[model samples]
Target: MRSPCASCVSPGVVKVLIEPLSNQLAKGQLDFIAECLHGQESGVMATVFKVSGEIIAKVASRLFLKPDGTVISNIEDELLVQQILVDVQQVLNQGESRVKSYILPSGIAGVFLEVIHPIVPLVVFGAGHDAIPVVNLAKHQGWHVTVVDNRPGYITFERFPNADQIIFSEPQTIQNHLDLNSRTVAIVMTHRYESDLALLRTLLPSSVSYIGILGPKSRTQRLLQDLKSEGFLPKDTQLQRLYAPVGLDIGADSPEAIALSIVAEIQAVLANRSGGMLRARFGSIHGEEITCLMSV
Candidate 1:
């Protein structure tokens, strides 16, 4: 678990204690917050408190504080919910927890916001000798890893002892073997051109955020061209999401080094960042400022 920010509370003093009321509300369970705290603390301190309320609640039905000191949760407020969504998007884009203040339309100014994201999921499409290092490295980062391969011998428990799931299935049956969501980072390294094509065909249409193909750029292009020839014309947006010739340009020679590069690229994609030297970038390394309006 991530520690609270040093500046969020006073030293040796806990003004707010956060505890999940139910096991269902545990972190990584809920998609978003239900009730958000919005009020003034100690006359000067601005704070926003968020608590999980309902599991099936939509963002519009989620709770929020109005400028007139009203808490709304039961009813849908499209405008207010849209603004709150903007705030949520900013927090997700920043890829970290942060405190930001928002001013209400009524001119009141005591709303602070923060977001806690869930653990990222990594899915490796091949469980070969080379994928062993990748799975181990990703597990070390506390990510949920699912290893899938069509070959029964390769996809064995002994090979991937630390893997959360070792699936033995064809590339076309990926959906039945694993869950693919927006937080999933998928890597295709089966080394079989036919299997790679089939996996890409299935994954490209899904909501997975990152899809990396482990091969040369020309090879990936050829696969795409083949798909196109077969009447599978992926949209430009889907094609853009693909990271062919996966991993960074770090001159990785060994399996472990290659794993490092791939993991780094996935991390950068999750953070909505360019995998570049931070020293060359200006301003905050996190992201730009996210201005939000607190209204109902």
Candidate 2:
């Protein structure tokens, strides 16, 4: 049940084309993809594979494959779909997108894989005036920002107009409201020793990739000491995720400047890069060069 008259002539080499989303995916499929993103699931979106010089077996215009091997497609060729699934797995593992070409009984097939990742989730544990700038910067970068404070009066929409969520809960109950995962980055800036200690006790064992404390080194050490005294000792791996005296060494004094450094550090940690000057790097500012297409 291949797509009717959907074949296209190739120009020998890979020629990527950009088309409207509606042309490649149905409205229902689009909604499903949106749901996956909202749930913070990482997946791959692939265009129809081009067979040899023509896309003869492209029954489905687009395909979405989750990391767990779940596929959403109408393509009838099971073998071809499986091959594309292999490529999808590769893309997911590498966290990169590229074109993969295969040689089949019919001819060569090429598929363009585009990785889709969920929005980074930022949880600001303090809704003080300083947290306002942090939320603003994170939202501008399209990250999902959540502001949590024990004081209902501090967590208000007016202060954090662009925050995705404003939660009011005691530090002890914060875990009940938050679904912290590897995609989450948090900052403990409650400006209260007791509150920071409580939040750290909760976050240390969680799956958050980054946990930044907004105080001096001594304060963070005290928090850890208190947690240890309470019999909740953080492992070495957990301590590695903690960023005390949070933010880059930007000599920031103003709230806005400090916010910039904090946000920048989060970006670097997620990207697995040191927060260093770009001018010092010899390679591309983004990362290593990526090959757009490969035929094998």
Candidate 3:
């Protein structure tokens, strides 16, 4: 069980706890050592669990901050590693808990590669019909999703069941309201050209990790041209690197298939892929080509 001290439990001191598990041992004793420390009672608990072939990292920083309230998983992920600060907010917001149980996860050795994911947070700009599948895919693929939309009906909790946060507000207002950073991703699939362009214009100049347009290449290009003409030339590499007609060219026509493509691009980007072929490309492989082997 873990408890937060009032001093350290504030709007600060959210550290990423690195509890490395021991290896090269026949005994399973040392691998499950539970340590507890009270340092000004800061609001943050990052627990590492071993499940089968993966090392699950659970982070609880907001809303559902508890010893067993949330967990990180491939299917039922708990930590929003992309939004570590948000998770910290949840943890710090825990205020005072009499009993906190920070349990450790179990697993065997000789498995998957060492995953070093950036602390980038993902914020989906639309809570439309596509938002459902999109958020689900995002969760499974390990992303912190914030579903935003203008219509209150669509932004309801029931509509976005798996969404971490359902925001009902204009895209422009919401874009300026959040703490968007370099590790943040904005997916525009709201089906409204104006709304999509509005958010993209605002976020394009920031340090966002990715900006994916949910339309055709020509349309995206036109939008870009329009924005540039309006004196909003997003000069950042991320903006300049926007994935238009978002998703892999899988000839996807349905919402589900389209969602797949969009997520595919994100996966490619996350895996550091250039969306190209290794044979056609050059020598040194720092992306999908060489990275795949290194992961294994």
lDDT against the true structure, per candidate, is: 0.66, 0.78, 0.55
lDDT of 3 by residue, 1-296 (tens): 13211212124443222233335321221111111111112223332222343425432121222223342222233432344334344434532222122332432211111122333456888777877888887877756678888887788778777777777778778756677766577788888989987887777777677788887789888888889899876665755658776788878888788778888888778656766666897753432111111100
TM-score of model number 2? 0.81
* Global CA lDDT computed for model 3: 0.55
What shift in Å separates residue 56 of candidate 2 from its native position after superposition? Answer: 3.0
For model 3, state the Cα shift of residue 119 in Å: 5.7
Clashing residue pairs in candidate 1, if any? 37-49
Name the candidate that leads on TM-score.
2
Q: What is the lDDT of candidate 2?
A: 0.78
lDDT string for model 1 (1-296, tens) is: 22222233333543332322345433312223312212111011112333233322232123433323343444243443445556645544444444443344532221234443456678999988899999999999878889999888899989999898888899888898777877788999999999999999899999888999998999999999999999999999998889989999899989999999999999888777789999999976656432222311
Q: Candidate 2 on 1-296: residue-level lDDT in tens? A: 11212222332343444333453344655665576577667788776545554434662366778645677876555666779888888878777766666676656666667677788999999999999999999999989999999787889999999999999999999889999998899999999999998898889999998999998999899889988899988999999999999999999999999999999999988877899998899855545322232212
TM-score of each: 0.68, 0.81, 0.56
User: Which regions of candidate 3 are displaced past 4 Å?
Assistant: 1-115, 118-120, 236-238, 275-296
